[model samples]
Every structure is written in C-alpha cells, then in structure tokens.
Target chain A: MKVTIDDVVLPGDFCEDIIKAGEKSRVILGPGLRKELEKIFITKAGVLRKRAPNTYWVDSYQKRYVPARGENVIGVVIQKAGDSFRVDVGGSCSATLSYLSFEGATKKNRPEVQVGDVIYAKMLVASKDMEPELVCVDSNGKKGRLGVLNDGFVFKCSINLVRKILNPSCPLLNSLKNEWPFELAAGMNGRIWIKANSMRETIAVGNAILGCEYLTSEEIKSMCTNIASILAGHVS
Target chain B: MTTKRPQLPKSVLEMKFMRKTRERIEKELENTQGHDSLYSNIITNEMRHATGNFISESSFIFCEDLLEGRLSYKGMNPEIERLMEQDIKTSDPDGEMQKDVSDEILYKKMEALNKKRKSNDTPNKNPVLKKKKKF
Candidate 1:
C-alpha cells in the first residue's frame, strides 16, 4: 500500500514521500490525498499526480461529481426556495444559491432566475455532511462570467474530460477556438454548456470536445479540422 | 513551549519606572505557562497524533494548471471574451504593456515633430521659452 507520485494509487495507500516533503516545507495535498499521523493516505483509486512546489493529487476517472469548495460548476435551477434557489449540480443533493449572492441582488430585487435555467456558478460551500452551496458572484461582488448560462446546449461528460480540456496544454480548445464563433462554459462537475451561431457549429463544437477526450494533440488537431470541414458541408 | 517572540531586555524589565509594563509582560509569560500546564494532563494520546502537513484539496483546477473553462472566442460572446481578456491581463500584467512602443523611440519621435513644428511656425519666436521647456 506504499506508493509514490505518478503511481497507480488506491485507497489506504500511504505515500511516505509526501509526508517527508511536508515535514521539510509546506506541501499541498490536493484531492484524494489525505494526511494521517505523519503519513499521506490516498482515498481515491487513481494515478497519483503531483504539481510543482509540493502540490499533489490523484487523477481518478469519475462521472459522479462530489462537489468541492471554490470550483466553478454548471447547474440548473430546480426550485425557488424563498431567498435561495435549489440547483441540481449532478451531486447527491441539490446545491443552494442565495438570491443575495448574485451581483446587485437585494431582498427587494432578487435576480430573476427561473426554474430549469442552466447557470454557471462557483461552489461556495461543499461539505460532506451539509448540502453544497453555489454563488453567482466572486469576493468583490462581480459576476465575472459566473451567472446564468443563457440559451446554450448542456452536455454531460466524465469529470476527467473536463480537466483534460481545461488543461493549458490541451490542443482541443486551442485548435477549435478560431475555427468558428462559439462560446463554451465547462463545469468542474462534468457538464459543458456551449453556444454557437448555428446548430451545426454548436454540435460540431460538442462533438469535437467529446471526440478529443481520448485523442493525442496531433489527432485532436486533425479531428477538429475534420469536424469543421464536415460542418461546412465539405466532405473532408 | 518554543516561543518565537523575543524576550525584552532584563535591564528594561527591572527598571522601577517600567513596573506596569514589566508586570504585563511577566503576566503574559506566566499565562502561557499556565495554559500549557492547565491542559497538559487533559491532552490524550489521540489529540497529540501528528496528522502530517498535507492539505487536502478537492478541486482539479489547482492540481492541473487548468485554464478557466468559460470562454468566448471569435466574437461569439463579447461579454465573456471581455472577461477572458481581463483575466489574461491580470495573469500577465506586463504582456500587453510590453507590446507598447519603447519610451526612447517615443521621445525621439516627439522631439523630431517638435523641431518641424518650430521651423514651420515660429522659428525664433520664443527661443528662451523652448530651451526652458526642454529642461
């Protein structure tokens, strides 16, 4: 049950390397890595990954999302509960988004959020025992791209795919961005909401994303071109 | 038990005029000792367990240097693109600024333009004023 960074780690696996580094300096134990009595234990079965400057995590393939604090998520407003809206963020229970949490929202003027509206929000509180909370604004009360996602097609994918596409080195978005006019919002909770000028472009964007999930950078580039050409009615 | 706060000078603590301040400092030291002794017997072995120095993060954004997923490119959503541009600027403050013309070239261009204007308009109208303006 002993493993190092980048190894296939399982539950109960102890990482002494992380513990030793933690003792020397400040170390960040990211998702799936826990500290227990001078030993780092893995809680999720996945490949243990590490970032520079002592940050470590486990990359597990997951579809069911366990909400975490401070992660941006796409959710649908399920119900209006007095001062807050209950959102289904693909978790066990729905998250609560207060009307006051929205920018410029007050008790007199609640943000007009209708039921079934897809929204891009930040996870404000995500505890195991309590229902997770979502917020539409940042610390400075600015909406800043966190708000109701209007008129976009929402699709589900594995949480791993979300991280892969969001990664800076990923060529999927970079190669497809300039191909057409499209807007995309990928939630950490494994949902992508995308909008484009036409239905073909939107589907093309979504298919490109879903197709590049298991592709190399070069393959992804070619796939994007193929999608773009096919959508343009050229049989390439 | 290892206090990082530096202790005051012995002579300063012993001064007659510094009686009140010295008493307060002595009280603070004694209070720390009292706090330790008060809980010494109450702390069980389980409470003293070293839980290591790792912090569990729940989000993949920090683990994977991920870009903000919300994006608008090719004039899709002007508002989202504006926010993205702002984020890019804040992340690299000097990137857009570095693209600006260098100060040396700007100064040289301004001087040449000023000489041409002076020649065309008032070649010797205010010679002293022009010299002082340069300074």
Candidate 2:
C-alpha cells in the first residue's frame, strides 16, 4: 500500500499484513504525515458497538429541557385533550395549547385539532415539570400563525435541525425546493415548531433539512425563503 | 436626592437567584420524571450468568488467583487439566521460524502465535497481558 505523509507519498504494504494476520493492528505515521496519510489509509473500519434503544451510552444525568416562554418550537399532536391536545415537541414532556389561543371570533367555527397534526407554536409557559404552555399570536390578537394545523406530515429529527432552520440561510436547506405551505419556529428550550399540509411534503422538507451535510448561513436563508414562498402559494 | 429603599447585598441576591432556579428545576424534574429513574440499569442476558450466592472461602481464593494470572489449567482441577492436553502442541525449533521481527512487522509473529499451541513440556504463556505481582 502507498501512504502519503504531508505531500510526500511513501510506498509500503500496510493493510495486506494486518488483514492476513487477522488481529487488531495499528500503523504509526508521525505528526508530519498523520493528516495526509489519514486521507489515504483505506483499510481501517470504524469500530462501533451496537446498543439497545432507551439505553444511555454515556452519563445518565444530562437532560434536554422542554420549551419555555418566549422560545419558538415545533410540535406534533399525539393525542387530544379537553379543549386542547397533547403534543410532542422534542423534549420529554409534550406541550399543550387551549382552543382559546386560536385567532378569529366565530363561536360556531372552533377549529378542530386532531392527532398527527403538526403545528408551529410559541412557548408561553414552562412550569418546572408541568406541560409546556404554548401560544400563537397575530397582530390583531386574532389567530395569525396560531390556529388549526392542516396539510402536512409529522416528522421527527434531532433538535439540531430546529436550530439550523431558525437562523435561515443554512446551506442544507437551499439545495431543494418543493414550494410547501408551512410555518416553523424553534423553542429556546429545544423544541421545534412546524405547521404544514400533507404528511408527505412535511417529511420531505424535514428530511432535506436533516440530510444537509454542508450548512452555511446563506444556504439556510435560501431554504427558509423557499419554504416561505411555497407557503405563500407563490411556488408549488 | 430623596429617600431611597435599601438594596439586597450581592451575596443575598445570588442566594435568592440560586434558590429560585433550584426550585424551578426541581419542579420540572418532578413533573417529567427523569428517564433513568423510570428504567432499570441492569442488562439481563441469558448467555452470561451473574452469580450472587455465597461460596466457600477457599473457592473464592481459587477464583481470585485465576483472575490474578497466578492460576491456569495447571493450577485448577486435574480433570480440566486432562482435557486441555489435546489443545496443546509440543514446540519445535525447526518448525517454521518467523521471518520478520520488527515492531512494524508484528503481523508475522501474531500469525505464528495463533497457529501453535502449548503441549505438556514447556510452560504455556498467556497471550493476554498479565498484571505484575506487587513487590
């Protein structure tokens, strides 16, 4: 095998010897050549131990907090409650919002929120251990962004995506566009808020954001703009 | 300037802040129930047995010796010693001698070790590193 140290390439049979012996092996290329050779060493396989789910791989004391007031977040309605619903928003506890939070003043036209609905709501309250309180506000105190969710799929991903999406112009979001109607907010407490139509479209957008390997501020903004355009019905 | 109300000392202000934070966190912990508290830590697999029963003091000493590398099949029960003889091989100098001996060429030595086994004649060294006894 040929290995490169810095810019200089050295010719040697390294990988063949290790595989023939069938034992744990390591090759030492000094500091000068470590980086250059790292790109060339093709035989080393990543050693990862499989673990069961719901199991802690490291220290167990660390925790991610639920959304708190003033934080933007994404939520999925997992079940319905009296005049409200239970939603999972990336934290251990789900958030809840009452029917009173919606905009519009028609007593007969109460919007129905069902299981699997996705919404982008703001965290109004997070009483230490209690369900997070969420609100959606419009300038007129009528429902603006807060209201019944329709036309979107519910998708789950790491909370990091929430952060990546909130800043806009993240590179990962710019590569693709499927003009979709959706509103997104990320809670300071680590919850993601999303309201979109069509489960398929929502999942498509979520996967694109999650799959972006290279993210830059400009790319994030482009992605946000595309999403907003789709929601505005300007793009399909 | 007119009358002004007294302000809390920095230490007092800090104590109050910490107290409120702790109370808030505690309340959240109570409501959410920490994941660790909800699940058991032990992994119960049938392939390995974890014995917790009492054993004779002498038996424990024997196990401790095995773990310390002072004991092997030779030191254990004689019946186990008989079964291990089949796996051992008598050493030979004329047998395929290793070609390379450099630190960079340890693969040849490992290959030889894997093929050859120890017979009843010479001592069989453990492939695994052994802890040195305290002086």
Candidate 3:
C-alpha cells in the first residue's frame, strides 16, 4: 500500500512509496522499517516519518532500552568485573565497559570508575546474542562530551520522551536553557541526569522536561516560561 | 583409446632447452585442473557476480542524527559548557554565520593592511633617523 509520511503504521503494512522513491536514488530505511525481497515492511507500530533526502524512520513509543550500536547511553556502574565494569543501562542485559576504553586509560593507569557512578558512554558493539560493549572515548581517542556524570539526579522516563527532548527541532531545551543555569544529560536508555546550582533549580529543570512530554511545541515553550517564573517565586 | 592431454603454449614450450620453464608450466596446468575438480561444486555462479552493496540491518540509532543530550546554560557546570563550546566549535569550525569572503575582498583587505603597516613603519623610522642625525 502507498502510505504517506506521518501516517500511523503497523506491522505487516507494506509501503510501496519507498520502492518508488528508491527507484530514483538510494533510500535509507531507518529503525522499524526493513527491506524484504522486493517490498518494504514495517516491523513496529508507529508513525512513519521521512526526513529530507530520502531518510525514513518510525517514531514509536517505547520504554525498554534495546541496545543499538553507536548510541550514547547513560549507565550506572553496577559491578567491577576483572577488566571491565558492568553497567546497568535500563536494558534487558547489562553492558560491559572495558577499563581501557576511557580517554588516556592504559594498562598501568586505569580509569577511576566506581560502582553507583553514572557514566554517559557510547555503544561500541551491540548484537542480539552477544553482550553489548561500551566505550567512553570516541574514534579520535578523545572523550568529547561523554564520560562519568557527577552529582546529578538521574531519573527514568519513556524513551519517546528522551527522543522528543533531544530532537534538534524540539523547543523544550531552547526555552529552558535561557531561563535557568542547569546541566542536563539525556541517555537514549530512558534515563536523564540533571544538575543545577541549587536543588530547587534542578527540580525545576526536571519538572519542566517531564511536563513537556505530551505538550506541543508552542505549548512546551509557554510551559517552560511558566515553570521558570514559578521557580523564581513570581506567580505571573 | 587413451585421452590426449592438453598442450601448453607453443611460444613457451619452444624456448631453448628451458627445463625449469617447461616443468613450471606443466605444474601450473596440473594445479589449475586440480582446483577445478576440488571445489567445482562449492563455487556458485551467483558468487562471481555479487554486488558490492550488501545491506546489513541494524537496530541502533545514530547519535549524530539527534541533538546532544547533554547541555548547560549560564555557568552551571562550567566543564560541561566548555565541552559544549568545544563541540560547537568543532562541528562548524568556520561558524554558522561565516561570511563568504571572495578572493577580491581578501586581496583588498591584505592590500589595506599592507598600506597601513607601511605608513606606520615609515613614520617610526623617520623619527629614529631624525634622532640619530641630531646626535
């Protein structure tokens, strides 16, 4: 069937629209869409989304974290194994982070990672049968914006909410960033860590994010302002 | 009746008493025949014309397609903000609002800078020379 973009799609729904688009050029089938013999099939129930230049994906609401390769996730150090640390990333299985994966970590110099510490790391290898492996540093051997998160409150939300807030076009962060000075780290595994100068400000940031989960872009902007004012003790 | 063996190239066999060359050619022919019989059942016609584009399905989402989850405002966690600044600098090294300076504009700016430097240098040199001359 010819399903247009933003249409609510379900499993067993075949999209001939992608085949037509692919005829002209290459088409990328992102998550939830798969290519069969000659047709494209939807594996998950969600709204079909198409980005510019023939990229398509299904935006499905999910809570459980299915480890995928190359995704940065927030994990808590659960156990220190022989040479690796087991991290609970809210997934079915815990991921292992090699001690040497950190930036400048060598055999003689191991990274100071303790149990119960939250670390934002990338999934280096995530396979169905094998255990997911995580790395702290990027390909350039530099820890660019990924490492252990310190002194922040971590909470779990729906994975869809995390995706919504992390989207570049999302207005939630844009409105809140200017209102208060707070730091936030949202992991794809449905975990968010937030830190601010005071506990009140941190709670405000967290509340604003949680409140905007179901609101539209316009509504989210207004909600952010309201939250900011309330936190500032101004009822207006 | 006995089956006749395939002959080597006349040019190679015609070489003057080259015993090693003839033996090598015979060995190569035997090896080719042995290989054809050894794995003839395993090799498929489709394997010879395989395309380079092999599509492997993955479940992971690319982080680049999404925005950075970590963000800081004002002076909250200066370390994270510094990392964010570095990320922004590296993402668009030339910056988002970089003006497209053409070759003509660059040359004009260089010429103007040179003119200003030359004018300043001449004045400074003249004063020093005048002081030396007075001494």
Candidate 4:
C-alpha cells in the first residue's frame, strides 16, 4: 500500500512522494527507507516522516542500535585489548576504541579507560565490512563532551524516545530543564546516561523522561509541572 | 567517469605556471593507461559500478538535526553547561547575523567566483586562458 507523510507504513509499502522526488534529484534514504532497481520501498513498520529538502525516513519504534558514522553514542568499555578497548554500544558487535583516539593520548601516556566504564563517544567508522570504531576526540583532538561518563546511571529506552527528547521542538527537555539541575547523555544506540545531585532528583528526572515517551507535548508540560511541584513540596 | 582522461588545453599546458601540474597529469594518465591495459581482462564492468547514487543513513540524528546528547542544564555540571552555552552561542542566529562581511558583499564576491568556475567547466569554449583582473 502507498503511504503518505505521517501515515503508518509497513514493509514493502512505498511512498509516492519519495519516488516522485527521487526522479528529480538525489534523495536521502534514511533508516527504514530502501532504494530498489526502479522504486523506493519501506523496510520497517513505522510512520513515514519527511524533513525539509528531501530527507525521508520511517520513524519506527526500535530498541536495537545499528551503528552509523558521525553519531554520538554512549557506550560501555567491555574489554581492554593490546592498544584499543572494546566498547559495546548495544549494537550487533562491539566497537573498537583506540587508546590514541582520546584527547592528549600518547604512546607513553595512555588514557585511563578501564573495563565496564561507561563512556560517551562518537562512532568514527561504522562500515558493514569492518568493525565499528569509536573515538573520544574530534578532528582537533578535543574531547568536546565525548569522554568517560562518570557517576551516571545508564538506562535503556527505545531509539525513537531518544530522538524525541533530543528534538529541538520537544517540550520534554525544555519543560523540565529549568525546573531542576541534572545532566543527561543520550546515545543514538538507545542508552541514556543520567546524573543528578540527589537520588530522588535523579529518579525523578529519569521517570519524567521515560514517562513522556508516549505523551503529547501539552501533556508532557503538565507532567513536568506536576513533577516540579511534587519535587518542590507544593504537591503530594 | 570515463577511463579516458581529458587533455588539458594546449594553452594551459604551455604556461610556465602549470608545468608541475602538467607533468603530474601526464604521469597520472600514463600510469593509469598502462594499468588499464594490464588489468583489462581481470576487471569487469560491474566493478566500476559498485558505488551507488543513494546514500543510506541508518541513524535519524543526521536527517533530524538533534542537539548534542551530553548536555547539562541550570549549572548541574558546570563544564558541560559551559560547552552547551558555547554551542548555543555559535549556533545563535544573532551571532550569525554579525558576520565578517554582509551577505550582499559575499554574494557579489561569489558571483565573480562563479564566473571563473564557469570558464573552467567549459574549457573547450575558449582556447586561450585570459588573466583575471584584480580590483
């Protein structure tokens, strides 16, 4: 069946708008969208979504993380190899993080990355043929928020939920940001690393984020206010 | 594209400024021509067509411009908050508005650049390369 924007799309279904746009110029086929010999087809069951200027994808509820290049992800250092550590980003295979990829790392001075340490990193090379590689530094060799995440509670959620809260227009973060002091690192791989000063505040922030997954923006705002009031002792 | 390399116009090849590039291009053409003859039977048509036009991105972060996940709000983490503020400042529309040069001047400069690029793209249209004038 043909699907339009925001319509529930299934595997084998195609979008007329994408096909029409593909004929004119190069079209970006994001996740769940595939190009065949003559037509483009949907590969996942989800809502057809389009960003401005010919970007198309299916917003499917997914938990599994397929590593892609240039995505910031939170990962766990699982194993220490000769010169690199194996970090699991909830993908099909563990990605390799070289010791030299960290900021100011050198032959004599190795970065102190140990096993089972949660790290916020970027996917540097994620090709199908080779093992995925993670880097903690950018081109200028700066960490830039991509480093070991310390004292944070990491949790798992749907990839869509991560995208939802990270979206600029989403009220989930905006509504609750100023209410309390907290920090969060959301990985494209569906892992969330959160930290707060107090245990109650941490749990409250986590619950607020997880609760708003299926809520409307208006409902999310109200829920934020409710949580804020409860946290502030104005409400039971 | 085509395996055959386009020859540089005689005028460009004769210029003293292009002697180094001309030598490099000649050497590259000579090397590739030799390799093509040697591997003519080994290589196939399908090998060249392996790359495709469509780029498939598996993650939504690129298609949807998302904020950096590691963020601190209200001074929870001062370092992270500083970084967030720096990001906001860099991406702020007001900062973008205060450019080194206005768009009108930039557009005029780009128009002159396009004229040079247009001539380069169609080398066969002109046999001689005329020197560009400086303002």
Best candidate according to TM-score: 1
> Looking at candidate 2, what is the lDDT of residue A26?
31
Tens digit per residue, CA lDDT, model 2, B20-111: 75666568657667554554355334314433221111011111111110001222233323333432334344667666577656877766
Backbone-clash count (model 3): 0
Best by the lDDT measure: 1
Please give the lDDT score at residue B15 for candidate 4: 99
lDDT of 3 at B44: 67
lDDT of 3 by residue, A1-236 (tens): 55678899998888877778877776777788887666788888999887777777788888888988888899999999999999999888999999999999999999999999999999999999999999999999999878999997999999889988988789999888887788899898899999988888888888988988899999999998888888878423
List per-prediction Cα lDDT, in the order shown: 0.89, 0.44, 0.84, 0.88
Q: Which has the better lDDT: candidate 2, or candidate 3?
A: 3
Per-model DockQ: 0.56, 0.01, 0.30, 0.50
Worst 10 residues of 1 chain A by lDDT: A227-236
Model 1: share of true interface contacts reproduced: 0.95
Select the stronger candidate by lDDT from 1 and 3: 1
Better candidate by lDDT, 3 or 4: 4
Q: Which pairs, if any, clash in model 3?
A: none
Clash totals in order: 0, 30, 0, 0
Question: Which pairs of residues collide in candidate 4?
Answer: none
Model 3 C-alpha lDDT versus the unseen true structure: 0.84
Which pairs of residues collide in model 1?
A: none
lDDT of 2 by residue, A1-236 (tens): 44221122232213232122222423222111111221312222211111121110110111254444555555777877877778777666788876667665335676566788766666677666677877665446654334444443344544344444433344433333234434343443344334345555555556556554255566655655655556457334
